[model samples]
Target chain A: MIAIDFLGAIGRLFLGFLQAIGTLSVFTANAVSHCVRPPFYFRSIGQQMLVIGYFSLPVVGLTAVFTGMVLALQIYEGSSRFNAESAVATIVVIGITRELGPVLAGLMVAGRVGAAMAAEIGTMRVTEQIDALTTLATNPFKYLVAPRLIAGTLMLPVLVLVADIIGVFGGYIIGTSKLGFNPATYLRNTADFLEAIDVITGLVKAAAFGFIVALMGCYHGYSSKGGAQGVGAATTNAVVSASILILAADYLITELFFSK
Target chain B: MAVDTRIPKVSLRDVHVAFGPKKVLQGFDLDVMPGESVVVIGGSGTGKSVMLKCLLGLVTPDRGSVKIDGQEVVGISDREREPILQKFGMLFQYAALFDSLSVWENVAFGLTQAKGMTREEAKPIALKKLAQVGLGADVAELSPAELSGGMKKRVGLARAIAIEPEIILFDEPTTGLDPIMGDVINDLIVACVKDLGATAISITHDMASARKIADRVAMLYQGKAIWQGPAATIDKSGNAYVDQFIHGRAEGPIQVEVRA
Candidate 1:
């Protein structure tokens, strides 16, 4: 009897996971289809772009700056033991432009923008505002989901590009001022070693991360049930899921782009 | 020979919906005629809202057909359903106004977004609808969060009528209002429906609201409509369940489910 019960529990868990994936796949397809369809709400798309991209700049910038500064200091300490301190500039630029800048910005935006999207959309769901949209002959996918998805995918690349520049600047500041390194030498080192593909890869990763963040937020919130407590759960789930997916996608995309 | 060309504005036949082990509706049926006002009365958690959602295609029934204007709406694609949905206008329990938009924008959303009218063209009509609901032009720019409960309901009602729909649904329209305000809303609903000659379907536990707005009253119990009659004859409905519900008595044929 115990063996039967254990197998039953495991089976249920597997089924639940599969069901969630299926639902998310369907939701993604619907959102993408609506994104290209006409009767588009250009004004709403513009508004969401401003919210997801423009309003998110400061936090992403601050995170990138601090990360670059700390990385430069750490790389300097480790490299000094082997008479390789001068190599810190090259490593910091490569690391910031290729990985840390985009990943950190993606996670930060996931926490900030993802949670807000979930809360706002979840509240709308519980309150029946979504249903009201349907009754008024408006498709919630076109009116709500599609715009956010488009804006998030298109604008994260832009935000990540800005973050990459700011992070490199941060490394420059620490390298010249704190390390007693000549500013021209450090910049020359960084420019010589950094390839365009590194920056391009980060931007592509940011686009994927942005799409994941927005999609998770919307899917969880749209399916939220119960009431206030349900909306709260949806908000939490959106952040957790988006953060996890960003990390997972980062790894996969890095393997695709840079594997030996 | 006179042809009876008027089809039921909304109809559901043997509808059933369940969540896990709990069945919300079982073999439920209702037919609402054109230009008629019907009020569905039931206790909390008795699936009144679920029935409304089923009719609106927000919640799909596990079994049965939902029809609008004698055409089957169940199992149809959203693209095919859009034209049929355009006939409906719903006033939600909490007003459910979009907090992201200004009051005027909320009222004009269907016209400007769904019907492809320009904002400039829809603005005057939105203002006219607001005036019909006794709201001043000053209220148009205010956020929904800034409005009182009564004011929110009025804004919601104004938005519902802005498109001049042939069918209007009210989901607990007077639920959270004071008695006087509830009466005022009831009067407004009656006047608006009469002026437009629209079919109205409302669900409420408020007998006062039912008395004021209903041409016919249907009382639901055990997922089936147990008693139905003309509004004036509710006092003499002759069913013990209806008697218990109308009199607000705890002891009756209907048992309240109290979960531990």
Candidate 2:
């Protein structure tokens, strides 16, 4: 009986996995169709940019600064054991630009903007505001989805660029002043080791991460069921799904950009 | 032969809508002639709102057709839908005001966003509409969150008429208001629809509102319109379902679903 129960559990898990994948595919299809439609809502895009990007700056900036400072200290300590303390500048620049900037930005946005989008839109769905928009001859997608998608895609790269600069600057301050490194040599090493591809790859990752975050937010929100409880679930699901997608996509993009 | 020659501003024929296995609307038929105010009344979950949504093209009927000004709406392209939509204004149950914008901004959203009117051009028109619904210019600068329930409904009414739409839909417009406020909203709805010479379709369980605002009243039950008649004749609709609803009797033809 225990064996039979275990087998049943396994079968249920498998079905659940398939159901999740199927739902995600349906969401992706709906988002694509909504994105391509007309009666584009430029105002929604601007509002989302204000909400998701501009308001998010202080937190993203602070996180990047601290992350850079810590990375420099850790790299300095680790390299000194191998008698290669001079590699601190290279590690800080490359690490911040290639991986940390985009990933952190994605995760932060998933927490801040993604959750907010899901909650707002999900509440609207539950309360029938989306239905109201439709009845008014307003395409909820063109009015709601397109703007968030466009704003998320466009603003993320700009945010990531700022994060990368702040992150590098944090490392420079810690490395030169605290670690007793020569400022000129640290600056020169940082410039020499980081290539255009590294920065460009991070920006590309930022854009992809932005798309995933916004799409998941809008999809879960638009399709949210029940009332308050359902909207809460959608918010949680949006953040989790967006965070996972961002990490997975970051890996693929990194491989594409750097792998021989 | 004598002809039924009145031109309907909106009409639906054999409309059927389903969500998966649950049929929300089934072979629903309705006609509202130009400048007529029609109220659809039913208990919760009886498809009154769904019928209204179908006519608005918000929920596409799976079978049959909806026509606005004699133009079939079900399968028309977006370009074909826009002009039809421009003829519509809707006041939702919860007001559905944009929380980010001030009251006037919400009222003028369609005007500024869809009609290409500058904020300066739209503000006075929005204020004028607000005044028509008895809101002062001081309320225009306040966000939706700050407004009382009655105020929000008035703002929604203002927004609905801002563009002078030829048709208006009111979904449970008096659901949460006090009796006095509800009467005020109903009177405002009647005045606006009359002033605009607009055909109106409203769904509500508020019989007081229905009596105050409707030229004709229809009762929906079990996914179909069970009875329809001129407002003066609703008391003698003769159908058991309609009698049960208007009289608020629990022991009549309408069965309340009590979960055991």
Candidate 3:
């Protein structure tokens, strides 16, 4: 009987997982299709871009700069034992552009923007506002979810680009100031070591991460139930799910881009 | 053709909806006439809101027929649902006004976004609708976040009526307001519906609001409307459930589940 109960629990858990995946996939398809469809809400999309991209600058910028500085110091410290301190610029630039910049930005935006979307949409759901939108001849997918998806997918790359630049410069600051490396040589090594592919790959990851952030936020919020407690749960779930997906997607994307 | 005038504006037949193991609606049926206001009153978990959601396609029934103006809406695609939805508007329990937009902008959203009217063309109309809800131009530019509950409901009503729709749904339109404020909202709903000559359906547990807004009153119990009559005769519904609910009694056929 205990074994039977254990098997039942496993089966229930498996089915629940499949059901969640199905629901999320359908939501993702609807949001993406509506985002690109003809009846576009241009003003709302532009507004979302400003909200997701422009407003995120200060946080993303600060994160990139600091990470770059830290990476430089760590690399210089570690490499000096092998008399390879000069490798600091190359490793910092590569690390920032290849992994750190996009992943950190995605996670940050997930916490900030993702949680906000979930809370806002969850509140709408519990409050009957979403139903009100439907009755008013407005599709919530088009009016609510599509704009965020578009903004998140498109703006993250731009944010990643800015982050990449700032991050590399941060490493440059540390390399020249703290490590006593020549500014010109550090700059040359950083630029020469970084390839367009590295930047492009980071931007691509950013786009995917952005999509995950918006999708998780909108999905959780849209499906939220109960009331204030439900909205609060949805907000927490959005941030956690988005952050996990960003990290997991980062690894998969990295494997895809660089695997033998 | 001769009896066509008697056809229901909205009709639900044998509708069944379940969320997991819990049955919210079980073979529920109701018909609402054009230019008539109908109210569904029930206990907290008795599916009053579910019935309205089923009619609106927000909650799709597992097995049922939902018809809007003699056309079946049960399995219709979004393209088909759009025109039908355009005929409706709703005032939610909490007003669900968009927090990012100013009061007038929220009212103008359906007009400009869905109806394709330019914002310039829609602003005057939005202002008129706002005025109809007793909201002056002073509150037009204020964000929904800045408004009190009563003011928010008024703005929600303004938004619902902005399109001059043929059907208007009020989902507990007076739930959160003070008694005096609730009465004011009730009066506004009556005036607005009468002016539009729209078919109206309101779901509420508030007997006073239901009595004030309804032309016909339906008492739903265990997912079905057990008794329905003209508003004047609700006091004489002759059903114990109706009596227990209307008089707000604790001891009744409807058992209140108390949990620690």
Candidate 4:
């Protein structure tokens, strides 16, 4: 009986996981469908862009700068043993443009924008504002979900571009001021090692991460029930799901782009 | 050829909806005439709100149909549902005002966003609707979060009527207010519905609110309308469930689910 009960519990857990994935898949398809359709809400899209992109810049920038600075320091320390400290500039630039810039920005925005969207939409759900929108002949997907998805997908690339520049600049500052390296030589090395594909991959990853963050936020909030506690749970679920998906998607996207 | 002109404003036919193991509504049927105020009264969790949601297409019944003006709304596409939904406005239990929007903006939401009217054009109409609900122009620019409970209800009512919807739904209109404020909201609802000659359906457990706003009363129990009559006759409904519910009795055929 104990063995059977344990098996049953495992079965239940597996089913729950499949169910959540199924629901989120359907939600993403519907939200994407709305994104490509006409009668597009330009104002709502613009507003969401401001929230998801503009409002998130400071945090993403701060994160990228710190990561770049730390990477330069660590690379310099490790390379000095082999008398290859000059490699710090190239490695920092390549790392920031190809991975750290997009990943860090995506995670930061997931925390800031994803949680906000979930909390805002969750509160609206509990209070029936979403229903109110329905009664007023407004489609909640078109009105609420689509704009955020579009903004998240489109703006994250731009944010990643900005973060890449800031991150490389951070490495430059650390290499020149802290490591006593010549600024011009470090800048030359950094620029020479960076490629268009490296930045493109990062931007693509940013876009995917943005989509995941918004999608998770909306899916959890739209399905939230109970009351304030439900909204709170939705917010937490959105952030956790978004962050996990961001990392998973980053790996998948990297495999797709760079696989041998 | 004679034309049949007496189409019910809203009708639910053999509706059944269940959430997992719990059945909220079963074989629920009701036909509301145009320009009538039909209030549904029942114990908490007896599907009063579910019935309303079904009519609005917010909740789809597992079986049966919801009709607006004798036009079947069940399984309709979003494009088809839009025109039907345009005819409805709702006042939610907690007013459900969009906290991000100003009071005037909230009232003007459907008009400007859904109806494609400019903000400049919709402002006067929103202000007029607000005034009709006894809200002053001074309150227009304030955010929904800043309003008192009674004031929020008034703003919600104003938003409901802003588009002059053919049907208005009130979901627990008096649930969270003081008795006097409740009565005030009730009176305002009556006045607004009367002036527009709109069909109104209200779901509430408050007997006093039912007496004030209802032209007719329906009592739901265990997923069915167990008793229904003119509002004046609710006190003498004679059904055991209705009696137990209205008088707030602990001992009756109706059982409260108390979990330890």
Q: Per-prediction DockQ, in order?
A: 0.82, 0.45, 0.72, 0.81
Per-residue alpha-carbon lDDT of model 1 for A1-260, expressed as tens digits? Answer: 99999999999999999999999899999999999998787888899899989999999999988888998899999999999998988999889888998799889988988888898889899888898889888999998999889898998999999998889888889999999989999999999999999999999999998898888888888989989999999999999999999999999999999899
Q: Is candidate 1 or candidate 4 better by DockQ?
A: 1
- Model 1 lDDT tens row, B1-260: 68646788888899999988999999888889999999999999989999998878888899999999999988898989888888888899999999989999999988876687889999999999999999999999999999999999999999988888899999999999999999999999999999889999999999999999999999988898888889999999889999999999989998887799
For residue A248, give model 1's deviation from the true position in Å. 1.1
Superposed Cα deviation of residue B96, candidate 4 (Å)? 0.5
- Assess candidate 4 and give its TM-score to the true structure: 0.96
lDDT of 2 by residue, B1-260 (tens): 68669767899888888988999888888888898999999899878777877766667789988999888999877668877888889999898887767999988888876677899999999999999999999999999889999999999899889888899999999998999999999889999999999999999999999999999998887777778899999998878888888899989878898999
Rank ordering of all candidates by TM-score, starting from the highest: 1, 4, 3, 2
How big an interface RMSD has model 3?
1.4
Give model 3's docking category: medium
Q: How does each model score on lDDT?
A: 0.91, 0.88, 0.91, 0.92
Q: Which ten contiguous residues of candidate 2 chain B have the minimum total lDDT?
A: B49-58
| Cα TM-score of candidate 2 | 0.92
Superposed on all Cα atoms, model 1 deviates from the true structure by an RMSD in Å of 1.8
| Candidate closer to the true structure by DockQ (higher is better), 1 or 3 | 1
Which regions of candidate 4 fall more than 4 Å away from where they truly are?
Answer: B1-5, B257-260
